[model samples]
Target chain A: MKNPLYLLQRALTYLVLIVASLLSVFPFFWLLVGATNTSADIIKGKADIGGALIDNILTFFERVDVPLVFWNSIYIAVTATFLTLLVSSLAGYAFEIFRSQVRERIFGGMLLMLSIPFAALMIPLFTMMGRLGLINNHLAIILPGIASIFIIFYFRQATKAFPRELRDAARIDGLKEWQIFFYIYLPVMRSTYAAATIIVFMLNWNNYLWPLIVLQTNDKKTLTLVVSSLLSGYYPDFGVIMVATIFATLPILIIFFVLQRRFVEGMLGSIK
Target chain B: MLCGGERFDLARTGLARTERLNGWMFIMPALVLLGVFMIYPILWSLWMSFQVGRGMNLSFGGFANILRLTQDPVFQRALSNTFIFLIVQVPIMLVLALIFATMLNDSKLWGRSLFRTAIFLPCVTSLVAYSVLFRSLFLADGFVNDFLLGLHLISEPIPWLADPFWAKIVIIMAITWRWTGYNMIFYLAAMQNIDRSIYESAKIDGVPTWARFWYLTVPMLKPVILFTSVISTIGTLQLFDEVNNIPPNAGGPSDATLTLSLYIYNLSFRFMPSFGYAATVSYVIVILVGILSYFQFMVVRDKRR
Candidate 1:
């Protein structure tokens, strides 16, 4: 156990791990510490905590309605996450459980559609949104992204890993297809739903380019668009931006921490 | 399972067929929305790629637009830059991810899950926030310069955001930092499927650790690696955000960070409305992704052979 070779190996692993872990956590530390400093101090590369946290936060509140923006972001994120799970999981389960050639072709078509750059379609999509008079409505942002191809693919894979016995038993019990999907499949796949909830929420919450292009008014803006405008000003307040980022990222981070066990397994299922 | 009499019976089965129709009805909403939004725009952009016009009123210029792409210096520059980012960043990120996955896979390694989560944190951070952090850190008087100066490695601070070469490097580094963790999440998930006993036996047979990794894990993780590579290639080619954010302006320092996607953005938004050319540029990205994805599929197929 005291072998010098073992000691050397442990030392090397620890060094690599420590350096990597530090690099990963350093920006987060910077974010936290920056919030405690002023704009000038942050720009000057001040590393220690300053007494500007209250001032920075107060200035942030004065500049932006923190409560409204936070609510806007959470509402959009939650609704989008919920609908995406409901829509995509149903499609995915149907695709896997009820196999058909035509649906397979439809899935293939969706896959190809996934590769089309969202930027290319933004103008047309915006035009359509405006035509439908949904411009500035949160539905304008939520509707277009309801059927995420990535999430659909994810649920399809997870469905494959599902036990067939459950479905067969449900059939024997005379549960309607919808009922079985709702009652049996959904409950057993809580872990998958958890994973999807985190990912879909993260994506919808952080979505920037589309929302920036579509949502014109300040009230319609999500946390990401708000943050983007916040930084795009003549002089970005890094301290306050850091605070906003911390707030914006907290929900996803909390979800990730809570559901990581299922998340990793879901990722494996999806990828393979 | 279904043939002859039973096949006919199932086909004529009203109740069962109604259930099957319900399946299509279930997916109909997604399909309809995607068709109007995705398919129609894609076809429209493909058409716009052909027409050479600046504004809404336009006449078809046929292949003249393609000819312009051949001669336009900025377009040519963007094409090359996109290719460069695609070629360079994908490999580095994938390799780093694979290495991290391997190290983290070793159950003997201390703090495996913690390391994985920490490494994966950057991807979860918002694009704007990460960009702000990078811009500040790479500024002339930023932490990176201070660190280098303190280490006595560089006599003067490196012009990270100024020079063209360094600008590209910074974009690549920014991308690598943000995405390597994301790709590692995939690799880590894939690697967990691998049987540990294989590695254990390899160790027992005195296979060198490096050899074991090179021979065992790489082969086992090939499919997922290909998956990450294809996605990374597409992501890098559509490399708008990093360049747009890291540079002073959108693509700054004499257009060093000017990418195809950014150039397309400039055409539609920053510059005068050249919707046709922007649509043309968007088609180029579609083509690039199509070609790259096809080749990756081929490679994966061949590897399976």
Candidate 2:
């Protein structure tokens, strides 16, 4: 029989795990329940689902340009994700396959650049964007993010797992290098792309600081900016704000759940 | 024989030339973009830091901004607040993550995936959305106070967002909530890579459970612990979203939740645009990250020896 102390420890372990899980999940539950309640009910600390979800959503829609904001977010995120993946992957593939001393030094330098926080670059980037007449444009967001150093690092790490024989075989077939990358390398490393797609999409979709600074016009704002603006109103309707929060959150949550495994793989791939 | 050798040499050179060309072609787009966005901005910011100005009226001020920083109360507040967050929140969150990761690493643990998924769920929400949620939840009459009152844990509602001290706590709690599971995932991954036989041998030798964990598991996870701590430290130093959003005054109630990043934002845009001084404030974050990361690496390396 197991000792009493061991059994007690096991029981305590389960208890702690259960508590932590509940705490982790509680806010999400509150978000949903809060969405369904009236502003007054929420303020009164109501935890149960109420009959105000439709009202809240309608109020949120009225206060914000729902379709336009979502479109803006989706358009920027999709374009940025596609460009980042394509550009970073090509660099990653070349860095690995065409390994050279000069290129290796450049790659190392780029990695060091990763530690330079975005806060430092924002002022200059803003000025540069203003000079180029790109401020408040969606391209302003898309262009700068396309060559993400972190994603490139991730792709390079994942690329190490890519088989070399396939490349040689493609070359033997007289396929040009670009054609080999498109036809052979692309299909073979689809999982890596899928993982990267989810991560980059989430990042671009949820990007706050840069967009907050650059996108000044109401019409140009993304759903994230809209939600924050909604909260800043003097009388922030909790119910309505909850709905907006959910709308902003749902797309990435859906993507995460749908591509959950690859998302996990993508995260693990980063530190490897 | 000489003609044949020259032809072979020429063929090899031709192959090398094509390979080099292809490599440059492949990497050129990303390199050019990074050059335009990252390198240019870094150099520009460095130059801008030396030029003191308000709005567009600028003049060169070499050591002037540095002197201002030493005397600036707001800058000092932001720097100290950022360090407080880095010191307090990072270790708490990382320790919790490490503990949760070890518990979840148990093969015999039931509903392991459910717990893991739940813990990681917070990462899915956008920063703004989560901050909004937390703001409502921590309001004076919000769910947190209600729950605490119900449990008889408090005699009166605590002003979570309104008070200076509690506001900082709220930001710390919000960050810890959002990132603990993310760090936990790293630890869990590293823990899984650890061979199970090490534990089995320790158990066979009658090593106590706590001793086995303390001596064996913690030592093995040292690298990951170090890695997560450094990442968390960098993240804490750059804390902005939660503080900027959660507080009613946007890092107010006497600027208790004001971070260096938020201060930089205010300097450049919110207040009168002192772009030069703002750039200077941002450099402090860069310097802090460099020093803290170096210390973390050294501490981890020395412990290993």
Candidate 3:
């Protein structure tokens, strides 16, 4: 607690930061440099780029149906993202805007549901999906998550900032509820939607456990599941696996970079 | 001012009624969908919990599953493993997150935003990607072992994913690597919200940096700390993806990483469809969460003035 010890602690703090930062960001760098190295060099801990970048790309394409896998990931992410935003935001808006005693109790119950572990319900959920005859279908992954409690809570929190005067003005202009929601509310909340899109896309794209259980074959599998299966093999290839991880992780990184500014802006707004 | 008093009151009442109706209309679809998907399945599971199962052959055996849960070895292993994960991982992550957030919060630090974003990079990484990547990086002949060998830190490779003890260590490291930054973001957000006046006063008093953090920052941010711990507790309790994906659900050479969630999965699917038994096992998780979180909530409440 003395000044000399304080200075030492400050120095220690900075040291921890640099080391932690390197440890956090080092793997991505490894993946990038590893991608350029040959399968043998990569496994041997080569940290620099080698001449195998083109071959790695070609090999990735050759072994896995790269385009199909990419498309499957993209389609699932986009569709799930869109539907989740629509359903969750709609309910979120209604929850905050329409204050009633009964609705308040319902919202409270839903919040409690948010705290339940998913493992508690996953089997029963799978049973329901099975009964609906939706096994091996992407809809099984897409549907159950559409009413995500977290996103709904987020939107409700954000909607508190929306002005009541705007709603009154729209009503005075003879705009119906649906018309106001579509033309005014929807257009005004673009940043919120962007943030939600990135988060939801990441969830859908990287979704593993559920999709792994539901999806039956290689052809139907997403990139995440493929990487999992690759690791599960008897003689796993670290070099090939690193390449797979890089490919699997790139889209989400790209998405985060493109929309990160918006996410922060939205975070400030929602939290306020 | 323009309307008669009785007419205005009547119109206001009508508008209030219509708003209530509109509210119900808007939420109806989500409510119905949730009921069918979440609420209905929960009730079904609750029912199934009562019916004893052997290979999916269900027969009503009242309270039988609950009695069986008290004696199951696998369930006991899972409960203990889950507790170990929560107790260890949450504190390590929270401390790492707090330190990182504080460091990143300093404006004098160069590349603060980049470090913040990069630190957060793991959270958005695909789970399977990292799981596979960690398994390989810590493999017997892989990068971590080779690096340690070159530096003369270890006489031999550490068998990270093979041996029971080391496998748990590798899993913990993998989890910590992936989630530390995510939690750090939460702390960073909360720290930024804190007023600068408090820290400035502490500095002016010649209070040590560690004392300033311990006495000033922590008590102020107790709510956020409590929040992170609760979420982490729930996450670690349902610790499946990392174990299942990384070690490919075999857990290890001797199943050291077998978590409650993974056990529930095995019981239901990998084993011979002991749906009733699996339900019983899952309820054990619910009970564990319920008990631990109750104590945590009490601690948080006692902290709050």
Candidate 4:
């Protein structure tokens, strides 16, 4: 009787997990399928693959400035990722390495700032960017995100795992503060950086609200903004939308795949 | 052999002072950027909230926007919709995540890494892509309706986007599908950190599986549970992308899924720009987040006591 019950429990566990996995993964599969079908087929709930991949890709590129829009997304996401990693990791390293009363208070204040919704700040932020003549420039998108409080918090938590002795030894060797950081600390924390890179890149790549408000011109839009605008039209082509989505999703997916291990580890570091 | 002048100066200033200055120096870039972008904008929004007027033209209203909030039916609908999402979707996602995490934590579980990757994949999916995919999936003649109809679950296709109540349900489903795995990853990480000996002892003592999960696991996971809940609360209160992208025209079908963030967007950008009233609506989010988070923290605090 007990053995039968145990078998039943095991069966149930597998059943639940299989269902959850299918639910999570089926969308991407369907998304790929959708990209190959025409709009009418998609509307008809076609489940099978079609041979319109080339046609969809051609239409998507023709409808939108694929190269320019993709370049805009890449430029913004890459620059923002690099700058965010530098600024936030430095602050995190500093808060941990040079602990002080004032710094602690400031850190707490920064956490409170994190809770304030970005929606509240968008209008004023837009107005401020407009004043600076950065309304259509990519810099407006990159600037506000360079000092992400969330990334700073993540780096701070990850830095807790950094060995103190390395810093002490580097100082004893007469390395300047900056030299110690550049030569020793940075080299040691490669996995943390890898994890941060994946996360920050995905965030900047998929960022919608701020970019939607800031970027006005059709020529200046990122892939995400373009995809959104495409949907807003009177007669959206599902095939084209799917193709754009696939392209929008590819970079982040690639990053996630390449750095899967470190990404998970980075999350673990933050939780600890 | 350190440089003599630099060494002498460093000694005179003292290491603490050097550390203090270095700390400030390291954080200076972030602080400057945040001050200009985050802090300045936040303060500007606060001031704007108190004023009254249309775009670019404004004057001090002294609580006029606040009073306007009371009479704004659209704002009222958005607030209720956001709360409904917060109250319903968050718990469902968290509990599902907890269950999945616990199951995945078992070393004997088959295909653990595959399951973990599959589950976590949704969170990394692009917002626009996910929204577009969901809108298609839940369309009147979409795969979801087709499947349900084939299964004899319903007689007719549900008007997912056209109906107000169903739109909210579709929004909830979309959010849950996207976020449950994200939360599960957090819980899984925390679960991995739990000492294995406790579980081993429970098994040896013949404690049932459900009892072990409830008694042993839940208590240990309280902190992360609190953390995920607080985050999900903030995320839900400021819900925008799902509703905005899923529904037509950013918030359509009679504003059934109009989140607070979407409303703020509509006011500032979509409609005749009312920056002040929009700013005022934006504060409604801040106040709600503040109150809800405080209550959450208080509840956690009391539990410890």
lDDT of 4 by residue, B220-299 (tens): 98888988998889999989888888876567789889889999999999889999999999988989888877877586
lDDT of 2 by residue, B1-305 (tens): 24467778887787778889999999999999999999999888988899998998879999899999999999999999998998899999998998899899998889999999989989888889999988889889888999999999998999998899999899889998999889999999999899999999999999998898899999998888887888888888888878888987887889999999999999998998999999999988888887876777587678779
Per-residue alpha-carbon lDDT of candidate 2 for residues A1-272, written as tens digits (9 for 90 to 100): 38899899999988988999899999999999999999998888899989999999888888888999999999999999999999999999899888788999999798678778889999999999999999999888999889988888887888889899999898899999999999999999999899888888988999999999999999999999988888884468999999989889998888888888888887777554
| Per-residue lDDT over A1-272 for candidate 4, one digit per residue giving the tens place of the 0 to 100 score | 35989999989999999999999999999899999999888877887899888999999988888999999999999999999999999998898888888889999898668788999899999999989999999999999999988888888887889999989999989998888878988889987888888778878899999999999998899999998988875357888899999999988788778878876665555433
Tell me the native contact fraction for each prediction.
0.43, 0.74, 0.61, 0.78
Superposed model 2: Cα runs more than 4 Å off: B1-10, B295-305
Model 1, chain B only, scores a TM-score of 0.94
Worst 10 residues of 2 chain B by lDDT: B1-10
The CAPRI-style docking tier of model 4 reads: medium
RMSD of 2: 2.4
Please give the C-alpha DockQ score of model 2: 0.79
RMSD per candidate (Å) reads 2.4, 2.4, 2.9, 3.2
Clashing pairs in 3: none
Which interface RMSD values do the candidates have, in the order shown? 1.7, 1.1, 2.0, 1.3
Q: What is the C-alpha lDDT of each candidate?
A: 0.80, 0.89, 0.80, 0.88
Candidate 1, residues A5-35: lDDT per residue as tens digits? 8688678877776777788879888888888
lDDT tens per residue, model 3, B125-225? 87777777676577577788888999999998887778888888888888999988877877888898899988888888888667888998898888888
Candidate 3 C-alpha error for residue A10, in Å: 5.1
Q: Compute the DockQ of candidate 3.
A: 0.60
